[model samples]
Target: MAFTNNFSTSFHWWDRIFGTDTKYREYRARVKAAKKAMSKEQQLEFERKLMAQVEAEGIVAEAEAEKMSLLGGNKKSKV
Candidate 1:
C-alpha cells in the first residue's frame, strides 16, 4: 500500500471537509506500540529492512523526483 502519513493523519483533506482520521490514528498507535515492543537492536534492523524494501520497490527514485519537481527543480540528466 501507499504511504499514509503524508497529507494528513489518515486521509488528505481540503480542510475538515473530509477524513477517516481514526484509522490512521489507530494505525500510528499500533506502529508506535510495535516499535516500543522492539529492542534497540531489533528497531534498527526493522528500519534498515523497511528502507531496503522501499528502495527495492524503486520508491526512493520516485520520491526523489517528486520532491525535486515540488521544489521547482529540474530533472537531472546523466551524460
Candidate 2:
C-alpha cells in the first residue's frame, strides 16, 4: 500500500479562493516597477552592483570553506 498527500491540493484550493500570497505578489510588483522605472544606465549599474555582491558572497563562502579545511573541521571520523 502507498500513502498519498493532499496538503498541496488543499492549499492550492484555498489559494484559488483567497488569491495568491500577498507578500509574493507585492514583491513581484515592486520588482516590476523598479525595472520599469530604471533608465538604461541605471539598470546597467544595478546589474553591476548585483553581480559584485554575488561575487563577494561566493568569495566569502570559499574563504570560509578553506579556513574550515585548514582547521580540520571538515574531516570525517571513522567509528
Candidate 3:
C-alpha cells in the first residue's frame, strides 16, 4: 500500500487493500467525532499514529504474501 499524506486518499489505498473502504470510513467518522474536541495538534498526532499503523499492517501483509508464495500452489491472493 502506498503511504499518503492526505487522509481521504490514504483511505482509498486502504479500501483497495482491505476491500472494505466504506466500512472503514464509517468507523473513522465515529473516531473522528470522538476526537473532534481535541486540538489541531492532537488531531495531527492521531493521524500520524494511524498512518504508522497502516504502514506496519502493509509490511506484515507483504511478508505474509512472501511466505505464502514459498508454499507453492496454495496461494491466497493479496489485496
User: What's the TM-score of every candidate structure?
Assistant: 0.35, 0.43, 0.50
Residue-level lDDT for 18 in candidate 3: 61
Candidate 2, run of 10 with poorest lDDT: 1-10
**Residue-wise lDDT of candidate 3 within 1-56, one digit each (tens)?**
33322245636675566664644555478558858788888888887887677778
In order of TM-score, best first, we have: 3, 2, 1
Question: Once model 1 is optimally superposed onto the true structure by TM-score, how far is the C-alpha of residue 24 displaced, in angstroms?
Answer: 12
Lowest lDDT sum, 10 consecutive residues, model 3, at: 1-10
Off by over 4 Å in 1: 1-33, 59-79
Report clash pairs, candidate 2. none
Residue 69 in model 1: lDDT = 80
lDDT of 1 at 62: 59
lDDT of 3 at 54: 70
Give a tens-digit lDDT track for model 1, residues 22-69: 444554575577698899898778767765664554465456657678
lDDT of each: 0.56, 0.54, 0.62
Tell me how far the alpha carbon of residue 18 in candidate 2 is from the true structure, in angstroms, after superposition. 29
Off by over 4 Å in 2: 1-33, 70-79
